[model samples]
Target: METILEVLKKMEKATAREMAARMKIDAPDALAMLRDHEDRGEVNQVNGYWQLTGRASKKPANAVPKKTKPPASKINEAVLVKLLHEHGAMTSEQLAKLADTTVRTVASTLAMPVNKGRIVREKRGNVFHFNVVSKTALGASKLPESASKPAIPVTETPKTASIPEKTETPAPQSSTAFVDTIPQLVSTNGQPAALTPKIIAGEIRKTKSRLVQLEKLRVTVRTQTRLQRSLGL
Candidate 1:
């Protein structure tokens, strides 16, 4: 409280923000302090500014007044966007009047959204027209001209061929035209003209035994001749 009072005593007039800045306090705290002082008759409001009471005023208590800054106005961007979007477009001069803010503040606020692609602007001489970009038209604008036409899709039905009736196959041909062997696979006469493998094997064993007997006989004749010559017979 003393910090605010001392600041107020120095300046002819001060806003909440200015008082807060000098006193190292929040604006709301400064405002509350000022209101408390005003209630206690320590300070008074002069055109929305905080000033010391006439008794503490450095100027003559009846010295009328001098020009001072008006209360600071805040820019309402949401209202700005709505107003521009609904009203088609408007200049900063016109927007400031509608938003009850400074033209400079409105101009700067509108420019920020434009650089972000959220708004659009058009210029004419010294003034520029601003409007918030609407999302409803975005999709339609991005589509190609050819896409706008309704597509007529053609669906082709698959061709189904007629199924052939089932038919009986002829009996297999025994023509024997492709036969390679006759003696081994077919009968030449009604009699069994084939030789059994067992009979052939038996004949081969007999021939081998007869050859072994002849070899023994030859060995015995050589032994007898050698013995008779030794006995001189």
Candidate 2:
């Protein structure tokens, strides 16, 4: 009997019936041999025609390749710590911009408990700033006191020579009196005063001296509001 591969080599490809005829065997026996060859990865079938594995047509290459997403920007822990040390302290937004990454990533890193000992966070105004933990300053409470002591001596002579403080003392009493008169001014005029610069200028020309008093009144109101907030009243 002719071997299946020799028959395939001669015929390029052949059905089981054709193989049986060429090899002088039953079609069922030829088919069983072909299946065994297929299982061994030596032959394959297509449309009831059997062919050697090497003679099978290869799959076509893709014309358009699959797209891949760009890699995300990552900030190493050491690099982040180095940036904070070099730049003093920076907000998460600032660090994110410097590291070419998202603010969420920087925030997540700062939030990690593992970095607690290596980083320190402080609230400056309305935002939090992250800084490298300073081992030397950690125990140095005297550093602040020593720094503040020099400021007292530096500001003492300057405060005594400033004439503005002398003038500002009576300002509180005058500003307090003006605050009471504001309601009366509105009642008499039948409208609230417009505090626009143009209106202030017109009134300044008419009153000349009252603008200074008005400025003092604004400062007093702000101080009062801040005091009330601190006292939680």
Candidate 3:
């Protein structure tokens, strides 16, 4: 019996009927066997023709092509951090140049360590300096004491109240008043108080509308970001 590998090697591309005839087997039986092999990942369909799959291309003497490494931007952030640690603290511009990446990428990498409190910043005029904050310094009190100054006790000031507090009394209710005598302001009068319910309803409606708009915007932003990254923008 001809092996699947042998049949595959003999024909780079072949239909079910063609493969069956070549294998000297019935069409239906050959098709079934081919399908089983395909399901096992030994074969794949390309343009309606069966061919050996990548997984099945491994042979004793055949050298497999080495996979190319992804670009610097695609490198893991953790790996980048380790690389930076080995190289010591460097400016974002310097790191970007070294990594063969954009300054934005280097800034993003630095931001991660800074946010994690692993690094500290010092401002000298306009330029910012970044250094790894030592564990002892991080735990120490941030406030500095004046060596020549003596400690002074805080004094509380005495309170003086010559004026007495005036208690507010509620306005006398009108005997003929109804609905609390508060006029129901309307939109026509340039007062929107009466339209509170309508305004709230409109706000809720607009909120849902805005939410849908935001979701679409988020998807669009993601698509644009992906496209930009893919184009190396």
List TM-scores for all candidates, in order: 0.33, 0.29, 0.26
Q: Give the runs in model 3 whose Cα sits over 4 Å from its true position.
A: 1-72, 75-88, 139-233
lDDT measured at residue 110 in model 3 versus the true structure, 0 to 100: 53
Superposed by TM-score, candidate 1 places the C-alpha of residue 31 at a distance from the truth, in angstroms, of 32
Per-model clash counts, in order, read 0, 0, 0
Q: Lowest-scoring 10 consecutive residues by lDDT in candidate 1?
A: 177-186
Residue-level lDDT of model 2, residues 115-182, one tens digit each, is: 33567878999998888867776556446676646554445433223123334344345744664455
**Alpha carbon deviation, residue 83, candidate 2 (Å):** 0.4
lDDT string, candidate 1, 1-233, tens digits: 24567777787688988977876655654675576556556688767787878744377878887554464366556888988866778887898888886665575455446656677878978887888777876677778988988898999975444345578997665635323223343456633334567854765687699899998997898679766766799
Error of 2 at 171 (Å): 96
The count of backbone overlaps in candidate 3 is 0
Pairs clashing in candidate 1?
none
- Candidate number achieving the greatest TM-score relative to the actual structure: 1
Off by over 4 Å in 1: 1-72, 122-127, 138-170, 175-233
How far is 67's C-alpha from truth in model 3 (Å)? 25
- lDDT, model 2, position 6: 82
